[model samples]
Target chain A: MNPQPSLNALQSILETLLPQMEQGKFSKVECHFVRALLEQFKNHSRVFAELELSTRHLKEALGETENAANTLLTLAEDLQRDERTEDIGLQISEACAFQDIVGQRLKLVQKTLYSYVDFLALMGTTTQTSPATIMSGPGFTGEVISQDDADRLMG
Target chain B: MAVSKDMPILIVDDFKTMLRITRQMLAQLGFMNVTEATDGVDAIEKMGQKDFALIISDWNMEPMSGYDLLKHVRGASKTPTVPFVMVTAERKPENVIAAKKAGVSNYIIKPFNAGTLKSKLMAVLGPF
Candidate 1:
């Protein structure tokens, strides 16, 4: 058996070399598939980078949200003794602004994801199954059978 | 010149949410006087109408970017010496160099908090 190159490493190498190969001789289907694959790879790389950025932003947003919630909880606990409640309230408000930043970045991520799906469909790689017919959850689509109905069917 | 909390400050960003966030953060830092611009062009228009003590602007925007705005600010103007802080998601050395060449007083990366904002402001405007 021959050793195989890592897909992760191969992707980067191909990304650099594919454009040079774009002008090479090939059949119609081969050309189409190659170009589509190259495009898909670029789009995947972009989406991956966007996802990483969104993940970082989300982590920061969640941390700030937790801080705000904890501050509020503490203020609620020591309502009578805390003199800096107003300052803490303002701090919480400032901390909650993380959602706006995260929301903006996540919107970019969502747009890139949608573009990925569109690219797949364009390349004729998408399945024939209608989006509505696809399973949304474990038990969401199937019929709700009673225990009696199950027993009767089994019997 | 002493940096006063009462001095008018301008924040330019394409995102309304960011404008709100920056404004709220500045308010928390005791800087009550603040103005906003949606883009570099708008910021220039605002600059024409009034003088800002400091300018905090996002690097990316349509029609005119923050780099363009910085150049315009640094160009022949009454407030040419005003401190310009570049806020951006880009961390590339080339970007920092370009901003420095364009006369940016300071730089700030996104995903920053009020504390970070305060530190940058202090660096640019001196202690408040």
Candidate 2:
């Protein structure tokens, strides 16, 4: 019917279904059924674009953290030479702020990476599942297990 | 300010950036004689070649860590009693207690500023 809809249309349907999937009200059978629908819609160009963006964010966040560390080192040297203890303290505070920002960015990147992995698994293109997916597996397998079991089995 | 220019200081850290930072700080404090080591094994080897007045080491490192280095140094007859400082990311009370029990002369937690380093050095060495 309607040429089985394009990949983009299927992906949109899956995207719309995500909120329901996350609501936690769905039974195992219902979840599996929705996941099967997601599998049918996994190969959209938009998903690949999102994955690329997520990877870039991860790299950027890591680079920022490294750069902040290096800057702190240089500031320490300057402060020591001038015997400016107060300034050194201020710089350290600034460095810590950068560290906090980097941590937030890393979290965002991690979430995006998780989403990308889930998208990949839904497409049946990836045999691997994200460590984030504890109760889920390929083919919409509705397996309820402990956190430890999910960690060992998924990653 | 208390350290002598001739007194050799050993800086140990896995990250080159940290080593450079420590060296610069020491230099500013007027300690001209400084040596570098990547980890505990390298620090021990270097210490064997020449005695160091002070050893500043990072706690976490690959192969051999700072704790191991401190133990090795204290265990050595020639190096025993040498001033040792642990610079580390771990600032927990238990970690500090362990390092103190291991005979660390001073403990400087990571993200330390120049003032903290200077104060620690002065506390350990006294005013020059």
Best by TM-score: 1
- Per-residue lDDT for B49-91 in model 1, tens only? 9989899998767679888999999995586799998876544
DockQ of 2: 0.05
- Which DockQ values do the candidates obtain, in the order shown? 0.05, 0.05
For residue A8, model 1's alpha carbon misses the true position, in angstroms, by: 10
Candidate No. with top DockQ: 1
- Model 2 accuracy (lDDT, Cα): 0.68
What TM-score does each of the candidates earn?
Answer: 0.60, 0.51
Tens digit per residue, CA lDDT, model 2, B1-128 = 54576898999987676677777677666787999999999998898799899999988765797988898888989988989988765445555667777888888755566667787788678875
Clashing pairs for model 2 are: none
Candidate 1: pairs in clash: none
